[model samples]
Target chain A: MKSKAKDLTDEELHQIVEKAKAKDNRALGRLCEHFYSKIYRFIYYRVNSIEDAEDLTSEVCLRVVKSLPEQKGLFYAWIFRIASNMITDYYRRRAVRSNVTSTGDLIEEMVDEKRTTGELLEQQELRQAIKHLTEEQQQVIVLKFIEGYDTDEVADLVGKSAGAVRAIQFRALTVLRNMYVRKDGKS
Target chain B: MEQNIELLLDNCIDEIRKGKSIDECLADYPQYEDVLKPLLQLAVQIENLPQPNPSSEALSSALINLGKEMERNTAAAEISEAIVPSQRDVLPQKGFAASMKKRKTFSFFSEGSFRNVFRKSKLAWALSTFLFFAVVLSAVTVSANSVPGDILYPLKLATEKVKFFLTFDSYGKAELRLNFSDKRLNELVEVLQQSKTLDTSLLKDMLDEAKLALEENEIPVEKASILTAKLNHVNAYQKTVLENIRPEVQATDRKIVDDAINVCDMRSRWMRRMMNEEYQEQYDEQDTTPQSQTPNRKRHQPKRMQWGEGCDWMR
Candidate 1:
C-alpha cells in the first residue's frame, strides 16, 4: 500500500511540476506539502536543528518557486540538487563562523526532545560515524537508505553513474558496519 | 570476488527492502551470506533510524509566508504597469527645438534602409515618435521624486544627464545641474523631515555639485542670485529638519549636513551682497528715495533681507 501511494505521487509529480511552472499557487502548495518533510528530514539530519532545518526547507521551497520557470528535467533530481547546494552553503558559512569542519559537533549541541537518552546517544554515534565518511558517501547513504531513493534516482541526484552510486553505497554501508561493531564493543 | 560479492549483497538488500524475507533473499545468494548478512542487517537498521520530520505547524506557516511573498510581487508588478501610462500622460510636451534635435538624433541612427522604411509610413513615424518621447518623459517624471535609496534614483540621474545633453547653452546646462543639486537637497530635507534616514552619499553628491556650480562662475549673476535665494529658502528649514534627524544622524552624515549648510550660507551671503550692490546702483540712478514711487519695493526689501538673516542665524 505504501509503495502504491509512493507510485501514485511519482506519477502525479509531472503534472505538479507543470502546474508549478505555470505559477499555480495551489500546485506549488501541494508540491511544498509533498516535499517539505523529505527536504526537512534531509537538512535536519545534517544540521541537527529543527529550527535551522525548517528555515532551510523554507528557503529551498522559495528557491524552487523562483527557479521553477527556468528549470527542466526530472523534478525530483532538480529539487534535491537545490537542497544539496543550500546545505553545502549553509555548512560553508557555518564553518567560516565557527572554524569547524565537523557538522556532527553542531548536531550534538541540539536539544532533541523526541528521543530518550539512549536513543539520542545512539543517534549521535550514528551521525558522527556518518560524518566521518566522504561527502559523496554520506549523500549516497542518506539518499538511498533514509530518504529511500532508488539507485538510479540517487545517481541522477548526485550526478554519478549508477555503478558509481552502488559502489558508494557499498563503501558507506561497510564503513557504518565497522563503526557499529566497534561502538557495540565499546559499550 | 569482492566486486561479485558487493553486487550480490546490493541485490539482496534491494529484495529485502521490497518486503522479501531475509531468508528468501539469502537463499539466492547463499554463497555470499557471510558478506551479505551483516551488511544487509546494518542497512535495515540504518533505514529504520529515527529521522526528523517537519511539524505540520511549520509547514503551514511556511506556505502562508510564501503566499504572502507571491502576492506582494504580483501587486508590485501590477502597480508598475498601472503607473506607466498615467506618468506618460502627465509629461509636458517638449519644445520645438528640443523635439527637432531629438528627431535629428534618431535620424542619425536610422541610416541605411531603416531611414527609408521609417520615412515611408507617416503613421509609423508618428507612433514611434510618440512612443519614444512618452517613454523618455514617463521615466523622467516617475524618477523625479525618487530618493537616493530608491531604485529609480539612478534613472533620475540619467534623466538629468539627458537634460544636460539637450541644453544648448553652457550656463543653461549649469543652471539645470544646479537645480538638480537643489532638488537633491530638497529630497534630503523631505526625507529628514519625515524622520527617515537620509542616504548620506547622495547628500554629499548634491553638496558637491552645488559647490562645483558656484566655483565654475559661468552662471549669470541674476540667475545665480535666484539659485542662492532658493538655497537659502531650503536652508531655512534645515534647522528644523536637522533637529528631527539629529538622533539618527551618524558622525559621517552629520559632517555632510554641516558642510551642506555652510555651502548654503556662503552662497547666500554672496548673493545678498550682489543684490545689495544692484539695489545701491538702482537707488543712485534714481537720485531720490523712490520709496514713494514703488511702495511694494520697500516692503519686499526688508522681507528678503530678513529671510537671509534667518539663514545666517541658523548657520
Candidate 2:
C-alpha cells in the first residue's frame, strides 16, 4: 500500500530536529510519527525480522534523541546516519546467531500475511520473483518503491552516489518487470 | 526508443501512486500489456504481504536507552575534571614528593681533582694504573736493548725452509732420482703426483728415487720426514701397509701426510699472532703503511666515542 504524503514537509522536519535538539519532547514525538514507518520498513528489509526491525527502528529514534543535544540538528544526512548505524549493528548481532541461515526467512516473516485467494496466489508468485532478484536490486527497490524515499535520499541513506542509486533502481525495476511480466507462452 | 516499456512502468508507478490497487500496476505498465491482466493480479497478491509496522513501545524504549547513555557520558566528563589536579592548586602531589626526587645531573666531570679521579669506578682505576705502568715499562725496554730467543732458532727456521723446499722439484746425479727426504726429490714427486696425466707406475719409481735425498745420502732419524717421503714416494717400500694394520695405519699415515702441512701453516700463523701481541707497536713502527688501514673502528662507534675509552682490551 502507498503511504499518504505527510502534512509536514522536509523543511518542517528540519525545524522539528532543531527543536528536538533544544529538548522539545513534543517536536521529537512529531518527528517520530513522520519517519517511524520509513525507519521500520528500511530495517524490515535489511534485517527481515519483526523483532529486530522493531528493536532497530526504536534504536534509530533513540539515537536521534540522544545525539540531538549536541547536534545543531541539521539532520539531512546525519539522522539517516544514525539509522544506518542501528541497521548495521542489528545485522552484526544477527550475524553472531547462526550463520545467516536463510536470506529469505526474515524478509518472508516481515512480509507474510493472510490475504484473499487470488491476491495470495499472485503474491506468492511475485514474492518468488522477488526472491530471484539480486540482493542489490532488492535493496534499491525497497529503498525507492517500498520506503518511498526519493532516489537521492535513498542514495544518501545507502551511502552511494545518486547516479549509482539511479542505475541500481533502473536495473531493479527491469528485473521486476521481467519476472512479474512473464511474457507470452512461457513462464 | 520503444519508450513503450519505460512508459508502461511509469503508468504502473502512477497507478500505485494513485492507490488504484496493486491490481492495476501491471495493466498500467504497457510494457507488459500482453500479459498485464495476469501480471497485475499477481502484483496485487504481492502488495498484500503484511508489512508489520514496528510498535509504538519500541520507539519509546529506544528513547529511554539513549537517555541513559547520554547521562553516563556526562557523568564520565564530570568525574574526569574532579580527578585531574591543576598546578595552581597548592595541594602537594602524593605521587611525586620533592624530598625523594633524584639530584640534578652534572654537566661535566671534575678534572685533575683527587675526589674526581678516585671517584672513577674501581675497574676504570685499575685499568688506568695498569696501562700507565705498562706504557712506562715498554718505553724503558725500547730505550734499552733485548734479544729474541736464539737457541735452536736456526734449526727451527731450517726445518721450515726444508719443508717448503720439498714442495718443488730439482734433479740429482741419478737419472731417475728418488728420495722423499731430499728437497729436490720431494719437489719432483710433488710434480708427478700433481700431474693430471701420467703413467700409473710414475709415483712408484719416484719413491725409489728418494733413497739419496739426505745430506750424507743417509736417512734421517726422524720418522715424520721418512713417512712424508713414503707417503708420496709411490715406490719407497713394499710394506703394503700390512693389511692387519690397515685401518689404523691408513688413518695415522693419511692424517699425517695430508693434514700435517695445513696444521703447521695454521700453527705458524698462530705463533705470529702471539708474537704480534707482544711486539705489535714495533711492527707498526717498522711498516706503518704497507697498505694504509682506513681505521679499525666498529661501524656502530659514534663520532664522539673515543677508541681508548671503550676499547675491548682496555682491561
Candidate 3:
C-alpha cells in the first residue's frame, strides 16, 4: 500500500514533525503512519508474536505522540530508542507472565506453532540466532542488513563510529555463520 | 590488519549493495574469499528474509490509538495550563477563591483550603510515603539476588540502570558497569547451576557491560590500570567458569556460550595489553602525555588465541 509518510522527503518529514508538534492532528497521523510498518517490523523481528509486536508498536506510537514536542536528536533514532526500550519492557512483562527460563524456550514455542512452515521456521530460527548476539551486534545486523541501511547510516542511527559499526557487523555475521554451519551439520 | 579486513568486508558489502553477486565480490579478494564467503552469504540471507509489513488493520488501529493519545495529551496540556498559577491569578482578588470554591476548580490549590487539607493529611501522607519507601527498599533488596527468569530480576536491572544514570563521575560509571557485568555473570552461573534453561541474553549483556566499562575514558591512568587488572582477574574467572560449563550447555545454546567465551577471551587479552601499555608509559617518563589522555592508537584489538589445553574458539 502506498504510504503518505513513506513518500515524504527529509524536509517534508521535518515539516510534518514541526506541524505535529504544533498539534496538527493530520500531521501527527501522517507521522505515525509513516513509521508504523518499520517500527512494527523491527519489533516483530525481536518478538515472536504478531499481537505483541502490534501492541508494542501502538505503545511506541503513543509515546512518540506524547513526547514529540520535547524530543531532540534524530527523529528516527529517537523512535528506535523508544521501540528498543519497549521491547525490553515487553520481555520483562513476558518473563513475569510466563516465567519462561530462557529465550531458547520461546524460540521453540515459535517453532512448534502450527502455522510455522519450514521457511517460516527457518526465518524464526535465524531471528533467534540473531538475538544471541550482543545488543549492539543485533542493532548493527538488523539496521545494516535487514533494514538495508548503509554502514554510515547505521552508525548514525546506532550512535557508533562507522568503524565500530563495521566491526560489529563482521563479528555478528561471524557468529551467525557459525550458527548456520551448525544447523547444516545437524540436518 | 584486522581493521583492513573490516574495511574489506565493508567494501564487499558495498559492492553487493550495488548489485554485484557475492561470488563476484569474493573473486575480487581471493585471499579473503575463505573468510568472507560465508559471512557474505549470511548477510545476503538476512537481507533476503521476508520483509514483514504491518497489516492494514494494525496500521488503522495504531493510527486510532495515536489520535486518541493526541487528544488526551491536548486536553491534559490545556488542563495543566489552566491549573498553573498565572500572574493574573497571583494579583489580589476578592471573589477568586470563592468562585473557585463554588466551581470546585483546581484553583483551590492556591487557596487556604488546600493547605488546610494538606495540614490535616500530613500524618497520613508521611505514613504513606514511609510505607512506599519501605516497600520499594525491600523490593530492591530482594531483587538483588534474583536471576534472569525471576519475577524481581527486571527490577534489579532497572535499579542498576537508574543507579548508573545517577552516577556522574566517569570512573564511577565505569566501575558501576563492571559491577553490573559481574552481576550478570553471577546470574548466568546461577541459572546454569539451577539447571534452568540458559539465558544467552544475560551472557551477551555481561559481555556488553564489560565492553562499555573497558571503553570508558577520562579515568586516571593508574586507576584505569587497576581497573583493567581487576577486570582481567574477573574475566579469567569468567573464562574458567564458562569453560567448565561448556559440557553442560544444551546443543542449541552452545554456540552462543562459545561466542561469549570468545568475547571474554578477547577482553582478557585487551586488558593485558592495556596494563602492559600503562606499565611501559610509567617507565618512559620522557613521554609526558598521560596514557589515558593519549589517543588510543589501537582502535581494534586482535582476537587472542583461545584458552590452552585443547580448548579451541569453538567446536
Candidate 4:
C-alpha cells in the first residue's frame, strides 16, 4: 500500500485509485495524467515497435481499470509484471503460429532489416547466445542485463531465490562465453 | 598459462553490466586483479551497450487511460445501481397479469382446450427456436475475438488508486493490472478458480485475512481451497500484510505450469513432448522455492562475465 499524504505526493498515484473506488470521475482523470507515458516507454523498449507498444500500453491500462479494485503490489513492478506476461504470451503464441521456429531465430533474421549493422550483429549474437541458455536463465538475463533491473528485482520478477538467480546468471554468462569462443571471435 | 577467476567472474559481470572500463574494475578488486583483468576486459567490451528506456509520454498516457477507464466503470456502476428498482416496470406487459386481463381474447384463440394449445404453437415455437439460434450464433461469433486480452483487471485502491497504457504492437495488446480488495479477493478466488489460474498465495493471504476478520466476519473453508486452486501467479503489489506473496504465488505457479506438461503428454507425439518436457521441467522447478531464498547474492561476482570471449570464464 502507498503512504497517504495531506496533499498528493509525487508517488501518490493511488489517490486516483481511491477516488476511482468511490466512482469519482475527476480522480480517474488525474490517474491518467500519471502512468500512461511511463508504461508506453517501457513497452516500447521491450517490444521495439511503436504500434505494438501502443496496443500493449492500452491493454495495460484497461487491465489496471478492471483489476484495480483487487490488485496488490508496488506500482511499477506490478505493472511491469503484467507487461512482461503480455510480451511473453505474445512470443509463445507467435512461436506456435510460425510452425515451432524460435523467435530468437526470427530476431536474428530480422535484425538487418530493423537495425544498423553494428546493432544488428550485436543483437544477432545475443539472439544466438540466448537460445543456448535455459529459458529461466534467459528470462533472468533479459530482466537483469537487457531490461536494466538489478539482481534483487530480477529475483522478485522471476520468483526465485537470489542464489538461484545468481547461479543461473553465472551459467548464462558461461554459455555466452562459450558461444563467443566457439565462433572463434575471441580465439 | 592464464589464471581462471571463477570466483571473481560474478563481480566482473556486474562491472561489465555497469559500463565501467574493464581496466578500472580490474584495479578495484586488487586481490583478483591478475586473475580477472582479461575476462573483465572482454566482458566490458561486450556488455558496455546501453539499456533501453521507455519514452517519456508512455507513463503519462497510460495514466490518462486509467482515469478514463475508472470514470467509465464508476458511471456504469452508478447507472446499474440507479435502475435496479425500476426493472419491473421496464419489462414488457406480456406476462400472467396481462394474460388474465385479456382472458376474453384468450378463449377466442383457444376455447377447445387442446385447440388452445395448438393455436399459436407452431408460430411461437418457431420464433423461440429462431431467437435461440440467433443468440447462440451471435454469442459464438462475438466471443471468437475474445482471448486473454478481454477484461483486463486494473488496480484500484481499497481506499484511491495509483497506475497505465504500456506499449502497442501490430496486434496492439493492451496491458492491465489486476487489483483487488480483501473482500474482492474472495470473489476473485471464485472467478480464478474457474480458470484455475488464481494466485494461491493471494488465496492464502485472503484466507488469513478472512480468518482475522473471523471474529467480526466469517470465512467459509470451501472459500479457502477455491482461493488456493485458482491462483496462477502473484503480483508485486501487495496489501499491508503478506508482502511475501511473490514467492508464494511462484511456488503455486510452478505446480500449475505442469498443466502444460500434461498438454504435452496429450500430444502422443514422442518428439514434441520429450523436447517440451525438457524445457518445461526447468521452469516448473523454478516455480517453487522459499521466499527468503531470494535476494541474497553478493553484488560482486568472482570474475567479470565475458560472452564469446571466454566460455572458459567458468573454468
Candidate 5:
C-alpha cells in the first residue's frame, strides 16, 4: 500500500482519504495499505520488538478506520496521534519500557538491499540511543525526522506547540550526537 | 540564547528536507556550525533510517479484520435505522457513537437493539409470570365460592380432582371424596336458597360420590369404625337436608329430589345393617354363657329406633 501511495499525487490521496471517511471499504483498504509501512516503521523504531510494531500498526489502522467518520482534522495528524496513543498504551500495559534491540533482530529488519553493514550498525546505534531520551524527546525525534512531519504537524500529533516541538527535536538530536561521540571515544 | 540555537537548528533541518545541503545551511550560521553540524548530521542519518514494511500476511489479515468489523457496524446501523427513521439524519453527523446512543434511547421494541432492551423484556417476563400466578390464585379463590353455573365452578371441580389424585392414601381419598359430596349438597342448598333451578345431574353425582366413599375396597379394620361413624353422620345430615329441600323443588324436579331421598334412605339402612353385624360379632366373642341361654342376650341389646321414622331414627 505504501508502494502504491508513492506514485499517487496529493489530489488522488485526498480523494481516497475522503472516500474512506465515507466508509468506502476499497478506499479504506488503500488508505491502510498506504500508511501500513510508515506506521509500522514509526512503531518499530520506537518499540523493541518487530511483532509489537506490527500489532500496534494494525491496531492504529483499525482505530483510524473506525473513527474516520468522526475525524474532523488532518488525517495524517489523526492517524499518527492514534499510533502514538497505542504505543503509550502498549508500554503502560507492559509496565516496563525495555530497549532490547538485539543485532540479529535489527539485521532481520534491514529491508534495503544496498545498505552496507556499517550503515545498518549505525542505524541500530541510533535507535538504541534514541531510547535513552525522554519520552517527549523520542516522540519529537521520531515524528520530526523519521516521519518527516513538519514542526507544526508533529506538534499537532503530539499535542504540543510548534516551538515546543522544535526545542524537543533539538534536544533529542543533541543527546543523540553526544551518545554517538561518547561511543566513538570509547572505541 | 539556547532557544535561538534550537530554532536555528530546526530551520536548518527544514532546509535539508527541502533539498538544501546541510553544509550550505551550516555555513550561513558559521558561529554555531561546530555545535550544529553533528546534531544536523545525526538528524539526517536518523531520518535516513530504513522504514520497515509490515509483512504482507499481517497487513492482509488486518485489512480483512477491519472490513469484517465495518460490515458488522453497517449491518447494525441499518437495523437501527429501520427501527428509528427519525434518527437517520443524526447518524451521519455523529457517526457510530451517536447511532448507538440513539438506539439506546429510542429502540424500545427493537428485538436486537440494546442490552437494556433485553433487561427490560426480562423484567416484563417476570412481571407477566407473576401476573399469571396471581390470576390463577384469584380464580381458585373465586372458584371456591362458585355455584354450579358460575364461570369459575369448573375450576373448582378441576381443583378438587387434583386434590383427590394427590391424596395417596385410600382412606384420605375417601374422606376427601366424601367431603366433596358434602360440598355438593351444600351447593344444592345454596341453589335452592337462591331459587335457582337445581341441577339433577349434580345431585346424582353427589350421591354417586357418597356411595363410592362408603364402598372403597378393603378399608383397614382400625379405620373402619371412624369411617363408618363419619358415613352415618353424613347420611343423617343428607337425609335431613334432602327432606328440608323437597317442598322448595318445583313439581317437575320433585321426582329427582325423591330419588335422592330414597338413596339417602338406602344409605341409612346399609349403615344400620353394618352396625348390627358389628355388635352381633362382639356379642358372640364376649358370650361366656351356654349357647342355649344366648336368647337372654336381648337384655344386653341397645334400643333401636324404627327406620320408617326417617332422619329422626338416625338422631
Candidate 6:
C-alpha cells in the first residue's frame, strides 16, 4: 500500500498525528504503515531475526498507537525511543533466560536467514566487531552510520551532547578499524 | 590534541557524506592524514555495510497486527462514546458570545444573591419548593398512561429511568425494572388494540430484562407476588393479542411473542399460588374473630374474602 505518511510534509505529518490522537483509524493506519518497515529494519539489525524483528515492530506500533496522544516531542524521536527501549528489554529478557554472558553467543542464536554464505560471514564478522564495543559506542555508530541520523539527532536519542556523540563515533570507528585489521591479519 | 582531531574528523566525515574523496579531504588537512585516513576508511565501510532490510512478509504481518490494534482501539472508543457522550454532545454548540450571555444570565443563581433571597424569604422559598414538586408530580401523572405511540411516551420512559436511578438497593431496582417491563407489555397491548403495528423487538427486549430481574431473586416473595399479578395481566393480554394476530405475524415475530406469552403464563400461575397462600393466612386470622359478636357479618365475610382472592387475578 502507498503510505500517506511517506509523502506527508512535516506539517502534514503533525496533522496526521493530531488526527491519530483523536482516534482516527485511517490516520493511525497510515502512520503504522509508514513507520513499520523502518522500525522493523532497525529491530532486525539489532536482533538479527525476521520473526523477532516483526514481533518487536508490532509491539512498537501498538505502543505508538496508545501513547501518541500523550506524546509531546518529535514523532520520529518518540517512535525510536520506544523501539530502543523494546530492544533493550528484549536483550535483558534473553540474557536472563539463557544466562549467556558473551554477545557473540547471543548473535549466534540470531542468524539472519536472508543472507548468502559470503554475506552472512561478512555480517557475522561486522556484528562481532560491533559487539565488542561498549553499548553507548555501539548505539552512536548504529544511529549515525546504519540509520543515517545526524549527530544532533543521535545525541538527542542517546541523551548525550552532540560533541559527546561525535567523540563516541570517532572512538567506535577507530576500534572497529583495528578489529577489522586484526581479523584480516589472522586470515 | 584529541579535541582538534575529533573536530577535524567530524568535518571530514561531513565532507565525505557530501561527496568528497578521502584524498581531496586530506589535501586540505595533510597534518592529520595518517590518523584520519584509517578512521575515514572505516566510516565509509560502516556506511556501506549490509544493513538488514525487513522482509515483505514481516512488513505485511506488522501492518496486519497494527490494523487489528487500531480496530480494537476504535471499537473501545465507540463503546465509551455510546455509554457517556462527550461534553460537545451534551452542551449547546452556540458561539462564545452566546455562551457568555447565558453565563451572565445564570450568574445570579450561581452566586449567593438568589440563594440569599430564598433563604431570607421563607414564603418565597416554600412557594418555590411547592411549585417544583407540583410541576414534577403533574408531569409524572400525565405521563403515567402514555404508551409507545403517545407523545408523552419518551417522558414516561425518562421518568422511569429517573426512578430507577434513584432506587439504591438491588431489590428496589429489580422491582422498578419489573414494573417498567409490565408497562412495556401494556404498551404492546395498547398498540395491538389500536390495530397499530407493534414493536416486537422492544417488547422482546423488555421481557428479557424483566426475566433477568426476576431471576436475580433480589425481592422477597411478598413483593414478587404483586409483580406476578402484573405478569398475569400481561399474560392474559398477550394470549388474546397472539390469537388475534397469529395468522398475520411473521414466523420470527411469532417466536418472540410465543416466548413472552410463555414467560407470562409460568410466572403468573406461580404468583397466583403465592397470593392465594398469603390471602388464606389473612382469612384464617379473620376467622378467629368471635362469631357471637356479629353473626350475620361473620357469615358474609368468607364470601367477601373469596371474592378478594379471585380479584388478585384481575389485578
Clashes of each: 0, 12, 0, 102, 0, 0
Model 2, span B135-201: residue lDDT tens: 8556544532211233443443344355446644322222123332243323323433454222223
Residues B1-315, candidate 1: write the lDDT tens digits: 767766776787678778987778898767777777888887877777766568766776667556555444433443444322221211222432233233332221123323332233444546667888999789888989887677888998887888778987545765675677678767877676665566665566665565455444445544555655654555454434545565676655665556555555655676567567766865685776565675223212212322223223232
Q: Which ten residues in a row have the lowest lDDT in candidate 2 chain A?
A: A97-106
Clashing pairs in 3: none
Residues A70-183, model 5: lDDT tens digits: 987766777877888898899899989887886667667554346777877776777889878887897887777776777887888878888888888888887787777787
Q: What is the per-residue lDDT of model 5 for residues B21-60, given as tens digits with 9 covering 90 to 100?
A: 8788988899999999888888778777666567776776
Q: Report the lDDT tens digits of candidate 3 across residue range A1-187.
A: 1112236788998998997787765677678878888788777667656677788999999999878889888888888999999988887877833311245534544555444556666776787787677767877887787777788878888888999999999989988888888878953
Quote the positional error of residue B162 for candidate 5 in Å. 45
Error of 4 at B118 (Å): 50
* TM-score for chain A in each prediction: 0.81, 0.69, 0.81, 0.57, 0.83, 0.77
List the candidate 2 regions with Cα displacement exceeding 4 Å: A23-26, A66-78, A92-136, A149-167, A174-186, B1-8, B19-49, B70-315
Local accuracy of candidate 3 as per-residue lDDT tens digits, B1-315: 778889999998888878888888888779998899888888888887766676666776776566446545544443344333222322223432333233332232244533433343454556667878999999999999999778998999899999998998767998898899889888988998897568777787776687677677677655766777877988888888888888888888787777777767876887787778767866676377676785444322223334333223322
**For model 3, what is the alpha-carbon lDDT of residue B171?**
78
TM-score of 4: 0.38
Interface RMSD of 5: 6.7
Task: Itemize residue pairs with steric clashes in candidate 6.
Answer: none
**Total backbone clashes of model 5?**
0
Q: For model 1, how does the per-residue alpha-carbon lDDT over A42-85 read when each residue is reduced to its tens digit? A: 76666645577789999998888788899988787888889989
Model 6's i-RMS, to one decimal, reads 9.1
The interface root-mean-square deviation of each model, in the order shown, is 12.3, 12.3, 10.2, 13.5, 6.7, 9.1
- Against the true structure, what is each candidate's TM-score? 0.50, 0.39, 0.49, 0.38, 0.51, 0.50
Model 4, residue B165: C-alpha shift (Å): 60
- For candidate 3, the TM-score is 0.49
Rank by TM-score, highest first.
5, 6, 1, 3, 2, 4
